[model samples]
Target: MSRLLALALASTLGPALSFAALSFAAPLHAQGAAAAALPKPEYLTVEQLRAKYRDPASRFMTIKGVEVHYKDEGPRGAPVLLMVHGSVSTLRTWDATTARLKTRYRIIRFDIPGYGLSGRISDEVAANVQPLDITEGLVDALGVKKLTFVGVSSGGTMGMYLAAHRPELVERLILSNTPSDPVKYDHLVMPQSFIDATARTKANNGFQDMDFWNNYLSYFAGDPKRISAKTRAEYYDFNRRVPEKYPIALVARIGDGKQATIEMAKVKAPTLLLWGNADPLLPEAAANAITRYLGSATISRVLMNDVGHYPPLEVGDRIAQLIAAYVEAGTPKL
Candidate 1:
């Protein structure tokens, strides 16, 4: 059956059946505002994704009291490539590149807490948890002695944190469409206008505005056409399945981006920064500020002509090639 039809049917039956069937179906639909903004997937869950994608060596690891999902490919002892996804995005964001890199390095990707299949935080905790904690905990769980770190957007932010705080764990760093200093980004700063609008929207109980979300995605893609229908459908379905409050919580956590930027100079790993020059969310100037603070780090900037915030999806092959070359040439001598 078509994915949309299946999703509609599952939704009618309620959350239990929807979760069960969707988790097993290849490219299950992801429901949410973000999903409406991105490309649709053939499947959503790890099982469904595996059935459609075909990773010969894939497994799951429990870390930080959560079931961390990952795909391990290539030789067991080959150089490892760790991919961290952006906010509100799952590992599926790297599907295209991961498929290609499986031949060279052992590539791994996972969902952070409050995202994808990973568990959510306790309701009692008012303070937001940092994604870096999940990244570090997952690294330890995977038994990875050393590896390269590739992060996109917020994922890239986490990559910066990892390289800064745990330089010993990272061999190389690749950041795409991520602002090094969050404070400067308007979205992170959450001006009065945005805060007022968000509060009003919540008060009105208008949580799922498809048009607004789609427009946001368009800005991220640099063009709406770039986001495939399949990707959008799956993303939306995933959103619908998860709690509605999560995105609000995420927005608040990102507001602390300025604090993250302060630690940029401490990131010692060789870094490559990729930006979609046209990205509305994180402009080139924001990325420039990050490059400025990366001391003693070899930095190469690639301006994707037509892409936006989600470079991995918009230009997956090009990104994979850049990462492969950077890691191969710039990996520090042991």
Candidate 2:
């Protein structure tokens, strides 16, 4: 990220902003009030999102009464690969890496209910349903008996939950820049910038906040040049579509002052954690905190120098090679 930005934020919003969950109990009153005043995001419908974000191979299926936008490709007989996108992104984020792997493996990736092509959960039972529940239920609805999971950011956060709670479905895992409780352990804090971005959203009645944009680009790669114009536009569109409550609710799921129940020992599938040294969110040191819990499962840690939060995006070719090698040997590389 920007050292100047970090320094400015620390100086202006000093004494550490209190971390808040998505609940009223967590002191999220101000943000909630702001969200209440704000209208629901526009320009993203299931059909429109699919048209813009989905590939030709993409399809939509109803799972637990929710119309889930998904893509299933590659040889039917090949090994299955399930990909989960992050909070603000759609399955399209995996297009680059998925294209590379499709030649060798069956690829399946989908948009979460509140994101990308899925839009929002239109199901009658949408109330109180967790992302984990929707995701697992979707897998069952699709009859995906077994697969390896490739998750990033918030997706990795949910992936760990699924692996711990329902190990039978996941055969292996590639978790990149995953955090258990983001509110609790914010790798870096840029409070002023976040506030400024929100204010810019108010001023523009849209999501054209470059302060946050720069921060976001920084989150992806240390060198902002890697983030192309098209990538920037797509991210803006997807993120602008985000409802304020969605992120709050995501972080609030475990309740105020509580951490997600991630049983590392329960994650028996061989695990691969790809971290970027320049990751602005959870620095490499912070990312390693999750390793102690892998227990008996073979664990591989690939530390990419000079990369940022999203390894699969920053270094997809190298990441794909690592994943291919990992799948073949199916063993830890220490």
Candidate 3:
């Protein structure tokens, strides 16, 4: 893959690519030694996934016609924090951050439809919403009158739309490794090596080929060796659990996202924007676009050194602290 394509994919598709994993089948076979060492993707039953990925607090409920898999944790009546992960990421990606802040805040995270334990989008009334509308439906169903959002990448794009439209429900916002606008295929050009996992995903009915899963995930982490065994297991496990049709469906919407034209000016909630200095995906132009639209006092920008796309994975503790401070500073003291 060219450097530009990789950066664009890493920036725009950060978490979402988990929805889009290994279809690649034969490219690495030529490197016999390397190919022999890669782990094969394991296909798991829904039952198997429930056992492996389940947290005691995790629950399932039907909302708007779709089975929503979510976890609502921490003290009741405390400030609510809704975590929206980017593509390819499930609620589990926030496990580290949840643990860090659960004592002081209630955290809610769920799998977006087409990913994780979430099923297809409903065609019925209220159940048919995608992205922001889907987020509002889920939040309204949860009866959270007031809440904050921590959205990553595509999740960030979703939150931007939600906050812009539903400023009343969203109290504050934190967008990490995020995009102000939905990225298109033109920005996220994919070469063959990038989709080598496509065959793996299709062949296994949407479960990634283990070798392909590892490679695809390694891109987000920026180094394969740095990813932990537990993290690797979690990614592979969840990818296998997602229904094949959703990811396949995304193949058609490659250039699209929920964010059409970002009206950051329409957003009223206080927002924090974060990015890695090393992040290749978001060029200064794209990042500045949002900044230009929002009022200065309503938004704050922070850049991390030596980090890549996934900050919660790379510096969960720092992010947890930053969020805690941001929320505390903005919220009234009880």
Winner by TM-score: 2
1 against 2, candidate with superior TM-score: 2
Clashes of each: 24, 0, 17
Candidate models: Cα lDDT each: 0.60, 0.63, 0.63
**Model 1 lowest lDDT segment of ten:** 16-25
Q: Cα lDDT for residue 35, model 3?
A: 40
**Ranking of candidates on lDDT, top first:** 3, 2, 1
Report the lDDT tens digits of candidate 1 across residue range 1-334: 3453333222221221101212111122223322334423222444443355434544566654545566666777889889877745778889888877888888888766555655555543215444566677777876898999998876776777788788899878888876554232223332333333223323323332333345445545866687777677546545444353333232113333455545677877888887877776567886787788777577877787688878887778888888887788755553
Model 2, 36-62: lDDT tens digits are 545444555456655677667867876
lDDT of 1: 0.60
Q: Estimate each model's TM-score.
A: 0.72, 0.78, 0.77
Tell me the lDDT of model 3 at 94.
81
Model 1, C-alpha of 279: deviation from truth (Å): 0.2
